[model samples]
Target: MRGAFSTNKTMGEAPEMFYVNGFAKVVPEVQPNHVNNVDDSSTWYEEIIDDDLKWSFKLNSVLHKAISEYQDIALLDTKRFGKALMLDGKMQSSEADEFIYHECLIHPSLLCHSNPKTVFIMGGGEGSAAREALKHKSMEKVVMCDIDKEVVDFCRKYLVANKEAFADKKLDLVINCAKAELEKRKEKFDIIVGDLADPLEDGPCYQLYTKSFYEKVVKPKLTENGIFVTQAGPAGIFSHKEVFTSIHNTIKQVFKYVVAYGTHVPSFADSWGWVMASDQPILIDAVEMDKRIEERIKGKLLYLDGAWFHSSTIMNKAVSKSLKNETHVYTEDNARFIPGHGIACRP
Candidate 1:
């Protein structure tokens, strides 16, 4: 499992330029570089890199107006770790694990409820969430809000995997700061999906992680019996292997019920985590969803299906037992804790 940011630097000579996480080094690399989106849809970084395994930070990409363009990949440096724009591989399409992540984010709220027609997406400019939201034949309107315009433009240009998902005429794509944009809209949504980063601080995403922010700014926007969902963090990095638990506990304080689920992403070290909360319980039948996915979109995928999807929800015995035996510490005052050492949200 990968760890969060610490003060240590891998290279002693460039202490301020890089951050170290054991052997995996994340160093600053972006400096006054202009990205020319190649082949209309995808872009490549002209800067030379000796190794492909290491992560590099784009210096010019400040927290607000930063973007990273790589071959088959792009990242918006939104202060924290940034948003990933995938063009190729299992991570790109709505197949397997990626499908599970996006489907779970959209479906449970819709299928579990008696009525769901309108949906709002916060920060899924790549169109995956918007695409999945449109899958429901009952859904009437789909609103998408993302801070960076570059992500939407890049997806429309190069990511063909999302062509079917975003082609819907009912989709309303809004390129604006999600927090501020959602504030102005008087209309509430039947389901609200937040695809933003999980960081409590570090980037523009800090506000989204706070309970005060959600209660005052986000919660009231939901329709009656409306369900709210979002991407939390990795279990290994946040709460044992159930990273969304921290967000789950936080949301439970605000909403009526909060539950978390997991998915294994190839790009992430210990897969990824998701948090879904509502005034009611969400009993997702992955088996049924799988049949629907197969009937709806007939394609080969990497991480999700009936079997894998069902297995993902089952807590790993090792991780579950470890967490139960150990005490994890977390507080609103000191939310940030060391990663990968059991649970740290309680301290």
Candidate 2:
């Protein structure tokens, strides 16, 4: 399988969960009481907490060691990150995010597309999105690329729920930087899903969110009718009126239409964003989309359905209302989204 992939911010009584390696080694703590620091096994954000619960602390402390060091697999805490287990073997949450993030990211685009068959997913280390994309009987293939192989290894070793998603036969797993992978493939997909983190000034992923890169590296890869969907940022905290406007503005330069969507992840209260860009005019018919998704999804689920899509729109509007006009774009180049900053763009 590709790999495993939380939150503690809600009104209800949060569940009891913990963060640990596959072998069940406890993750470290950030503030200990409010938030615990998991060991640095994965390469995303810091200070993961069982925020959903009444518990004082929860998180693994594994440092970011090389892929060779991770060992063991076990369920640490379910209440913290909403994940059934924590893994240390591979370290990336590509698979988890695919189901959790990618579903929310891609389905909207697919709904907007008149016909979507071939797809490309960049930065999906866990292959969860690849798993979801396969649900469409009409889909031909899903090509997913990620820079870290270690994340995939640990997730395969630790998270069992993600096994099917990562092992899907139709998926082409590319263990390389997403931008580099995109450069090698030209106009090959009808839909492109970008699950990358905020761009860094100095890193392989920096180009994924750049204005220049989208115009050059990313745009050319799309088919004439393709729609590009991306996790923009935490809409809740980043109400970056400019960044959001800029993102929409930037994509409009190439595509005829650019829009945003939202999904509430308790783990990242103010740190979620998704952008859906397309060359054709788009409209989301909720009634039809829900029926399609319901017919496609097989297993049981506590969240996600047509109502979820409606809620996503509401959340986006709420975030938009919260943002000030002078706000700056909150990309990976800056710090993670802080809750009170009005920049939470968690679509």
Q: Return the top candidate by TM-score.
A: 2
Q: Which prediction has the highest lDDT against the true structure?
A: 1
Candidate 2 residue 207 Cα shift, in angstroms, is 1.9
Q: What is the TM-score of each candidate against the true structure?
A: 0.64, 0.67
lDDT value, residue 75 of candidate 2? 31
Candidate 1 has its poorest 10 consecutive residues by lDDT at 42-51
The reply for model 1, stretches above 4 Å from the true place, is 1-97, 237-243, 284-311, 317-334, 337-347
Candidate 1 TM-score to native: 0.64
TM-score of 2: 0.67
- The sequence of per-residue lDDT tens digits that candidate 2 reaches over residues 1-347 is 11232322333443333232122223333442465435433312233222231212233333333322222223333334534322322112322333556568767777667667888888765556676677776787888887767766655666566588678777788887777888987557888888764432222343466666777777888888888888765555444442444454455566677666666554443345677787777656668767776664454333456667666655444456643232343344542321211112111
